[model samples]
Target chain A: MEFLGSNWIVVVFMVVATFIMGFAMAGISSVVGPSRPNKAKSAPYESGIPDIKPVRPQFTARFYVIGMLFVIFDLEAAFMYPWAVNFDVLGMGGFVHMMIFVSLLLLSYVYAWKKGALEWV
Target chain B: MGDQPIWITFIVTFVIMIVLLTSMAYTTWYERKVLARFQDRIGPTRTGPAGLLQPLADAVKLMGKEDLIPEAADRKVFYFAPMITFITAILAAAVIPWGGTIELFGQSVNLYPTDLNVGALFILATGSIGVYGIILGGWSSGNRYSLLGAIRSAAQVISYELILGFSLVGIFIITGTMSLKEIMFRQHETISFGPFEIANWFVLSQPLAFVLFVIAAVAETNRAPFDLPEAESELVAGFMTEYSAMRFALYFLGEYISMIIMSLFASTLFLGGTSGPGADTYWPLGIMWLVLKAIAFLFFYIWLRATLPRFRFDQLMGLAWKVLLPLAILNIALTAFFRLIGNGQVF
Candidate 1:
């Protein structure tokens, strides 16, 4: 009820517009476009090929390990962006929070290395 | 508290959100059409006059489809993932100063919801919360690609978020206020450079910071040139591989909404939010001017998507930490020095 004010009228128009537009478009397309539903047509797309066997490939956990390593470093980068942006304004609080974040992340990086997640094959 | 009804603000925001969502949904169609034009092919002309209804069709298809949950996935986290994404997307829109106040009941109410002194910081916080959705969705998926994509997503957000935040510090130093509404209002008091207007828009004064902000924003939103996580050629839809129906749509909506939020934020922060010619004289004109500016940024987002190639994970991280981080910090230093010298440098 609170969200039913006049201001919400614009939003309601938006929602209805999106819904009506989307439904109408898709419905119209279905009517006009060819609808040939075959077993082969419904199969999971694999570049126009029939699957011989379900291939569950095995990869060295190394792919995941390196990925995790990348994430750790990437997260470090993320925290620094805002801290750097707010450094002057935030002053000591910003600096301290950033250091703490870095320290915690560094510790995890060390742990990952100790756990051998950084090794290449 | 304030005298104006909270419901009024809520209703206003709700409507804005709906408009934003629908616009984002159609942006997808626009992007496809534009990209198709780039590739020399027609895209979706069949769905209501020039394929304008394509986005609507997409939404219906997604909603009507069966919602699937993997057996190995954690149901609690799985369900919460989409909600988390959606919330983060909506929450970040709170601080964007859409325009100046509008008169209602003999008093004027600010178009923005709340202008915390720590408005920029608030954006950062809410923006970071979005990572939780991707991380949880990836972990809960019980699929390797999804997991990898999620991890990549977290890293990407984390990496670029820093540079992004850092770049804004320059703006803060120059403006000396974190409240976006205050910043816009402050812009009205002009600094004349001998009959030639030199300092009005932050983009005019702090071009470096503006460029860096746009780059970091692109990375943060995981758009192309930084879309490694969701690179269809590689990860098969990244963290959303296993998702289906409306659940998948939630993530989709989150991404587009976040883009819109960023565009609005950029408009408010750097492009004078709602301030323009005759903006000071009329309230509604100010709002229109703001929306027009914001739409410019939105078009830029679409333009970039259509033009740029997705960046490699390594290159993205490198650009953020090595390049953008240093550049942002440098801008901050310059702003601070100028502020100290003049006590008034246009940010």
Candidate 2:
């Protein structure tokens, strides 16, 4: 019991329990579940309908560009939240930390912008 | 509950575990509903009264479906992937302080399952390990799409993990503690608001960090706007392309649980978790307040899914490595400098 109350033990219990339950449930479900094989049924379905088009084709690169830009700004934006929450307690030190982080990220953003990574139609 | 601290821990943990599992089930339902709303259509209102029983029905169907492992797939690694995912998700919850301590039979037990000193670090490590499940699952699938998904997932995680670690470094520096509980207590302390006093919330002090955390967290969980790993349109359900039946469900549960864990961490770290407006006024209420706060963040996640678009893969990587990482570094330096200044010491 004392061991059970310990942090490490509790963590162990949780890890083990979740895996076991998932496995057990999965195992039980698979054991009694129906199995029927057919060529049409096995084939992949798209948008709730049978697929008639080719499997792969090249798409535009614009999505990648915008995605890169979004990710860059999105991440840069995330670091600010924690720094803002602890601003007063951190005072100058915290602000300085944030400034450095933001500035460095800002530099990358600028470079990306110059490289035409932010463009979209 | 008296003279049964161990038993109590078991019961509480079991109940919490059940709650998490059930919540994860419904989160899928929620995601579908939200996604449909975004696309402007009615989603899953057919089964069990407005689709309330949809998740349960889905579970039953998944259970009843045939289990399949491609003959070419590596049996060992393929089997282990979902297990790893499930395990890592549950590991993060260990340090979450669900509520403050409660008195039971004249003995007080902390509301959290565990209070490890390196709780934050533990979470980070667990998150790192979680990526492996995706990687291995994709690799073992022996499918090109699955392999590509795994590669993308690996790159995504690696890109974001640095920024994620950097963001937390700021929090650690400010709180001067790695323990989540300590950070929570530090929040419990207050600052003067003129003649009156106001309980310090991290949101006010660390807004930048909070925002960064939310963004990085969303990416880390591979949710919408950062869900390139499992992007259905491009990758045909990404890493789980060949996974079927309950194996698929394990991945599903792993994802939702990860989201819940992220929400809890965000609330605890930035939203003054469990430490409410008048936590000092009454101790028990502190935990209730924390739950409410965590719920708010959860809704926020759901809301983001409802409103946001998924990012391009390259864009996701660029943000993590270039933008977020640098900002996180700057954040840490700023937080350190301000703490010194606040102490009235020259640094």
Candidate 3:
């Protein structure tokens, strides 16, 4: 707990340093850079065409599905890390436990594959 | 923990921040030089002798350019987006163990900013958070190209991050630790082969994991061959299409710094970071070795950018989910099997 507290101090320092650098650069440019906003200049670029349609078009559902799958697998991977780190101490019981967990996840992966959820098209 | 004074910690953090910013500046020059050499052209030679001062010139030009925010853009998010990206990228460096502790004015000082017990997990979390910058930047721009680019980046990062996480499982299994400093110490053991003695780097025993890790890392950083998010010909600079002036520069700086951090992470994980001959006796030598290893990885990153063509979006996703992810899992399982057999505990 003491070590964690010290580490948080470093983390806070890092956050402060990053913000300072970022804002300082932005502030310098705002002071030095010229600004003249016009109808054409303020317009978002669309390859010299008069802007048509809303920018946020609906994307494919495949992306959403992939994201959901990613969340699931990511959780599985996170759980496995601590288990893997303590493999020696956990011994045979831990080994069996992880294998069962992995096998179930692998089944999900196979089912996803068979269902074409992995396909980008 | 060394229980060092807070002032020393601040000083070290300041030095690291300066060094990282300078390196990020020079990396652009390095990339241009290497890419030019690949195409048999002299790149940026006129900007102050071999273009050593090109980044300075570029920064000055950027500072003087008009800072434009689209009239239809979300004012607050547009301004805040680049800051988020830059912060996450820079913050990951806090946990990286650069070298062994050194004595300064009769006091011992560790090379890194902080020694987090959950170092690797912190890196992963920060990396994931960085995606928010791209997503917000693209969305707030109110540009079609920017939104498309953001979506692509979201998918690409998510896919590759899985492989990246799993690839390190083998190393964690072997070392029984996630703290980078502890892992480095564990790697200090020497292994002999007849006439030669070599440091027991994770790369030697877990070559497959190392290879997978590098590939995943390259994709995670969104460099060439997997740079679908920023494909210029198709998306007009992708998610960054709507950004200009300092905002664009912040994103650019973040990308390069993240590349350096990824290289440092790789070297520390697999190359017996800062552990070389005479390193234990003299700490500065360890820092040199760590820097050298990171530079090699950075060069390899540039080389790949020059050599490989960008992957199609679908192809990139397929490679990550189908090929790399499975391979990473298999690598972990293989490592476990071997470790169990070594310990005579296999059933």
The candidate that achieves the highest lDDT relative to the unseen native structure: 3
Model 1 in CAPRI terms: which quality?
A: incorrect
- Second chain TM-score per prediction? 0.93, 0.92, 0.98
DockQ of each: 0.08, 0.22, 0.80
Worst 10 residues of 3 chain B by lDDT: B1-10
Higher lDDT: candidate 2 or 3?
A: 3
Residue-wise C-alpha lDDT for candidate 1, range B59-178, written one tens digit per residue: 777766656666556778986687677776776666677666678778666677555566677678778888998989888876666777887887778777776776777676566677
The sequence of per-residue lDDT tens digits that candidate 3 reaches over residues B200-295 is 999999999999999989998989988888999999988898888999999999999999999999998999888888887888888888889998
TM-score of 2: 0.80
- Candidate 1 vs candidate 2, TM-score winner: 2
Best TM-score goes to which candidate? 3
